[model samples]
Target: MSDRHIQFQTLSDLYDDVLPADEREAVRRHLQSCEACALEYRRLGDTLKLCREYAGLSLPLDGLNDRTMSKIRSARTRRLVLRSLPAMAASVLVIVGVGLFSTGTVFVRDRATVAGSRLSYSDSERVIDIIRKHNATISQVTGEYVEGTVPVSSFNDLKKSMGFRRVAYMMVDESMPDENVHWGDAIEEVGHDTGQPVRDWAPLTGTGASRQYVRFRVFR
Candidate 1:
């Protein structure tokens, strides 16, 4: 594949055993050939191992049952919301984000890409409302495409509240600031992610990593 179809969060889910059997197998096959993804998969495992060890040393934790049930409830809620949504609701959203930047342009550490049919005008308004509700900065709006920065703290709520499917991670050329490129411009060049839609974004937090570009092309 010209563009990597694996997402950071998707790999994390695989490591955590959260993906369905077929999906998990697909990622495994991809990892076998993609050296970078394979390396990342290993590193992610190491990091999670360390985190688990660290938490065991210091942090209190909820029981496994509580955690498991919480995920079950959350998944059920998303399913219910999606089923109840009208035709006017966004049927599919594909989020693809680029590299993490620290200073110039926008200080973004996360990216979201949506690839599907163009959104209807009414649906576009609702998408914009969610972006605004999360206090994301809107820099560009062209047809169904919206480009801007979303806060790290609120990204999950925004993603979950709306329901979503994520694509692979992408990094733009060094000459271009990630915040400046729209998904449309980039997708044509690097190609779109092939991975099936799945869950949440990669965890985003760090010094100078305050907001992520929630640039999308699914709304007006």
Candidate 2:
């Protein structure tokens, strides 16, 4: 038997289906002529076939692709819902919180709670001064009021003066005399613009005010 006929490298390429058809035919001819190479090639082919058979036995082949794909899709759906849960809960909370407090008054103080406290008559005069010095126009109706587009300095002063850690701009419709109009819509608009929660409320008084205004009031 000849010590060399075809190299194992060529045989490997042929087995892997990487060899061109002509080269593959050439290797096949060499394998047919050489007994040693032919035996080795047959052994390699048998080993690969056995490995494939073993793999088929080890893995579940009944609806395997469908089941695996279904599991993957389910996992992705679960992850998507989990990601959206907080935003959903927060939206629900905002709706519920607004409904609960919409009819009642809210404090402009630093700490905002359902049962409002820390807002009293003693801070009313100081709060008004803070609003006035900031060049924020107030209603002559004895309630707190300010207009939008004021200077940032005045806004900060009002917040500090009111002892509130945060402040929100609420849009009021003067046309709605008895009740707040577009309150939720206003809250959404202001929240989107300022990225802050609307935590303050003031009465819309009948002072012959023709335009919408931002009002401030201390909740008792």
Candidate 3:
């Protein structure tokens, strides 16, 4: 009933599981009597949970950081240009619209798809380890596919280390819409579409490389 509320740092610490046990318990007890703080706490948890779920992704239903790293890498290739080019869309809030047309690279904003039947089932642990080293999150893994997001800057490293092919990629931008995409589905589709084997493919830079996710899907 005290109009006093807990501070933001306390709530953040609690969410991160970093607060001392006594402070955590005190916060919980306060939540029992306080509606507003509890609601805020729930919302924070929900948002982070949804973000984590963003990694186990699939197609156009698409959609860091060691976050400072993300900004640095994302800035490397991703340029946000608002210009009046010939026949440009009137509503060009677009950042990654034009791609290397000479290579016939089809552009889908904010996604990078990788695939390989060559991805050995035996390297499951190695794959996980590499992803882990990159500070990426693995959202889901079934026998057919391993799905997750990695730092775009480091994506090339991941591609080379693992034999998993870096078949195709597009820029990741904040302005993109959220869709319900998944890794398993993307690999199957891209492989069929591009017809490139694992060895023949080039590495992904996410060159428009966003950090928190240069999402990857590899066939297991």
Candidate 4:
């Protein structure tokens, strides 16, 4: 019989015992000659043995099932939110485009609000109102923002201080503002400055926005 490399998927199916009899026999014969496939099969066997050991372990912990289920639910929810993000952004863009085309008015008034300009104060206040309004929809999936202040340093420090895995930070651009005046741009700057990645952003404080300090949250 000619020797051929058995595919990982074929091996997986063989382990799961879902292969037809002829294919199973063929794979069995291949495994007998292929030292590399034999080693991989042994590794899979060891992993299964470990899983069995883990399943049979009795740990002293209260509410273990509840905690495990809770984590599972949280993980599933996060996955759902992550999966939905692109659609949500597209929907928002479509809504804004329609509003702009129909009403002859900008959907987000703060879209043009620039940093360090005289109009920033009142304009940002209005913009923040718009942000809060949009935040209502975002909170449906990400949960409410845990509002708090953190000292400006690095992105890792900010995340560590807030106790969040994924987050987006926002603050009013007081001065020394980069060309990005929009909320998304400003938040991106924060991400760059702090060396952390962000997904969503919203206003933390209105009018009297600070430059040194920032308020942020972990929502999704």
Best by TM-score: 2
Model 2 per-residue lDDT tens digits across residues 90-185: 434543444434434444344345224332333434544465566554432122222222333344445445443223445344333324543343
**Candidate 3 structure quality by residue, lDDT tens digits, 6-37:** 78778889999998888789898998889889
lDDT of 3: 0.53
TM per prediction? 0.30, 0.33, 0.32, 0.28
lDDT of 1 by residue, 38-135 (tens): 99999999998998898778555669789899999999888645533531132222221111111123342342232234353454556667766875
> What lDDT score belongs to each candidate, Candidate 1 first?
0.52, 0.50, 0.53, 0.51
Better of 1 and 3 by lDDT: 3
Q: 155 in model 1: Cα distance from truth in Å? A: 1.3
Model 4 stretches astray by more than 4 angstroms: 63-220
The runs of at least 3 residues in candidate 3 whose Cα sits more than 4 Å from the true structure, single-residue gaps closed, are: 1-122, 164-212
Candidates, ranked, TM-score: 2, 3, 1, 4
Off by over 4 Å in 1: 1-117, 165-200, 205-220
